[model samples]
Target: MRFTLRQLEYFIAAGETGSITHASERINISQPSISTAISQLEQELDTQLFIRHHAQGLSLTPAGRIMLMEAKRLVEQAESLYAAASEASEEVRGQLNVGCLTTLAPMVLPELSISFMSAFPRASIRPHADHQEMLLNGLHRAMIDVAITYDLQIPADIEFTPLVDLPVHAIVGESHPLARHSAVTLSELAELPLILLDLPLSAEYFTALFMKEGLSPNIAFRFSQPDIIRTMVANGYGYSLANVTPRSDTALDGRKVVRVRLSGENRPMTIGFATLKQLKKSRLLAAFATHAKSFISDAYIPGMVAPAMGQKKR
Candidate 1:
C-alpha cells in the first residue's frame, strides 16, 4: 500500500505506548488526530491491529506484530532521512567524511584533524579507519573525500599524493640481542622468529631481505592489528618490522619495544593523501590534504624523502 510514512509512525507510537492519548502527547498531535490516523491505517490494511477495551488502553493482534515491525523500520528510516537533512551542508560548512588505512590514521590523523578544523571552522570531520581497498571504495562512492593509506594498489579514479615516507624499523624486545646494536644485518634478523605484519608488500620486503642474504626468517606469526602485534612483541613473543615508530611512552611503554634501523633492507610504507579523480574537491578537503602532508613531514619523516612512489613504496 502507498500510505504515508506518517501513518506508520503514528501506529508504532500508539503500539509502543498502548494509549492513543499517550501517542498523541509523544508526537505532539491532538488525540482525535491520532485516533483518526490509526483508524485510517487499520482500514487501509484491512486488519484489526489493536483491540480496544472499555476503561483501558489497547492491545495488538497477531497481525499487528508484522505491521509493528514494518512500522518501526519506517520510523527509523524517516528519522534517518530527517537527520541527514538537518545535518546537510550548503557550502564548505557541511560534513566532511574521510577514511584512512589503520597504519596511517594512528600517526597522522590527530595532528591533521586539528589543522583542518583551524582552516575550516565550519566543517565537521568524520573519519573512517579501514584497509586500503575499503578506503578506496569509500572514495569511489563519495563516502569519503580523502584518505591516508599505504601507497599500494591505487585505483584510477583516485589521485594519489605522497604525504611522507617513514623508515621501516626492526622492532624487538629491549632485552633482545639486536636491540643493543645501532645497525643490524639482515642475516642477524633471519634467525629470529618473525611476527610479521600481514601486508603483502611488507611480507615480501622482509622476506626478500633474508632471501638476498640466503637465510630464511623463522616466522612465528602474522597479525593484522599493529597494537596487538606490539603487545606480543613487548611480551617477547617475536620480532616484527614496521615503519611507524611510536615516539611517545604510551606506544612503546618506556622502550619495552626497541625500534632499530633495518640496515640491509630499506622498506617503508609510503603514507599519502588520496581523493576521487572525477569529483570536484571542496575547499575543506583541499585544506585537509595540504595540512595532512605537512603534518607528516614535520612530525614523522626524519629526512626529506625522494618523490614518493605513487603505487608502491618498496
Candidate 2:
C-alpha cells in the first residue's frame, strides 16, 4: 500500500519523544490527532507499534522500530525534495555541468573557471574531462551545458564556434641539443624519438606537418597529459612536439624544458566550445563560452586571427 509521508512523520515524532503529548506539541497538532494518526498507521500495517502505560510514557514495540526506520527515510526523502525545489528556484545558482576535451582543459580552463566564478558567483561548475566523442554524447543527453573541445566538423545538430586557433610551439628538454637553438626544421626532428600527446587532433595536426615535409615522425611515446609528457621529456626519456607549449606554472620545468619555434611546420590546434544546436544557449553558457574563448586567445593565440561568426578557421 502507498503510505503518505504525513502519517509516517506523525508516527516517528510520537515514538522519538516517548510522549504523544510532546509529539503533538512539537508538531503543533492536538494530542488526540497525534494519537489517532499513530493508531491509524498501526491499523493500516496491522501491527502494534506503541507499548503504553497509564503512569509512564510510551515506548516503541518491535514493529514500531521497523516503522521508525521507514519514517526516518521518508523524512529524509521529503527534505531532499525541498532542497531540490529550492535549488531549482534560484536562477544562475543551480549546477552547471560542463565537459572539456583532454587537450584544452589543461591549458586555459583554470583561468577561464576563475573568470566564470567572478561573473556567476552562485552557479557551481562541475567539470568532466573526456575524449571528443564522450563530450559530444554528454551534450546530446543534456548532461553538460557546454563543452570545450578541439574544433572538428561535427554534425549539424551540434553547434561549434571557433573561438581561436592557439599558436603551437615545439618544446624539448633544456639538455636537448635543439633546445639551444631558436628554431628547428621538420627534417631535423624527424630522426629524433618524440613524445606526442596521444590526442587525435594533436596527432593529426603534427603528423601532417611531418608528412608535408615528406618525413615521418619517430613517435616513441604517446601520452594524453602534457604534464606527463613534460616529465618524460624533462627526465630525458624523450622529446615532445606540441602546438601549445607549457605556459603555466605546472607546465614546462624551466630548469629542464625549453620551447622553440618550428619555422615552417608549426601546427596550431583549433580549440572552441561545443553544444547542441537546438539548445537555446543560456546566458550563463553564452557568457562562459565568450570568456573562455577570449581567455585562450589572450594567453595562447599569438600570430593568429579569430574568424567571423559562421566562418571556419583557415
Candidate 3:
C-alpha cells in the first residue's frame, strides 16, 4: 500500500467525525496534520474521499464510507499483530485503554493504575469512565480493552471476572436516628425519605432491593452522581443506599455520614473486570487483569473500606 497506517488512521478519524478540526481534537493532533494525512491518503488511493463544504466541515463520499470500514478492520488487525508480538516476546508493553464505572473511577483507578504502571514501566494506561451501558458499548466498538464495573446485565459477548462482593449499606447523617444502629433493615428504611443514586442500571439495582421484599422506597430525591447523594444525605435531605463504602465517613463538604450494614438477604454487587469474549487477551491486558486480582479482593479494596468481617457473599 502506498499510504502509511498513520495516514489511514487520520483518514478514518476525519471520515468518522466529518470534520478535520473535530478529528484533530479527538486524536489530539493538529488540524493541518489531519488534513495533510487525509489528502495524502486520497492521493495514494487515487480518489476523492471527502466533499469539503465551506465552513460546514467535510462529508464522506460513497467511496470514503466504504474505505472507512476497511480502514477500521485493518487497524484492528494491526493491533492484534502487535499484541501477538508482545505475547511472543513476553513483554507487557502497550497502550491499554481501560473503561471504568463512573462511581468507582475516582476511588479505584488512581491507585490501581499508578501501581500497575509502576510495576510495568513500559506499559501505559488510558482511562475512560462512564455508565455501565456506555462501557459495554465501548467494548463492542473496540474503543476500550477492559472495564472495571459491576456484574449488571452483562451480555454473552462480554466476560466478567469477579474480584470482590460489595454488600449494600445505608448511608445516613450522623444526627439521624438510625445512625447509631449497628445494622438496619430495608423495612425500617422503606418509609423514610430516600436519596437515590439514579444512574441507568444502577437505579434499578437499588430499587429492586425494596421491590424484592414487598416494599417501595420513599424516594424523596434522585441524583445521578454518588457524591451528590452523599452530600444530600449528610445534609439530612434523606438517607441513601450504596454498596461501595468509602473509608472516610464524611461528605465532600466535610459533614459526617454513617454507613450501616443492610440487614436481611440483600444482594451484593460483584466488582470485577469486563472484557470482550471474542477478542484475544493481549499480554498487557493479561498483566493488568492479574494486577487487579491481587490489588482488589474481599479483604482489601482500594479507596473503600473492606467488606465487613463475616459478611457472607450472596
lDDT of each: 0.71, 0.71, 0.90
Better candidate by TM-score, 1 or 2:
1
Tally clashes: model 3.
0
Best of the two (2, 3) by TM-score: 3
Candidate 2 local Cα displacement, residue 212, angstroms: 2.4
At residue 220, what lDDT does model 2 achieve? 92
Would you give me the overall lDDT of model 2?
Answer: 0.71
Clashing pairs in 2: 168-243, 169-243
- Give TM per candidate: 0.64, 0.62, 0.79
Better of 1 and 3 by lDDT: 3
The lowest-lDDT stretch of 10 consecutive residues in candidate 3 is: 305-314
Candidate 3 per-residue lDDT, tens place, 121-198, comes to 978787778899999999999889999999999999999999999988899999999999989999999999999998
Worst 10 residues of 2 by lDDT: 305-314
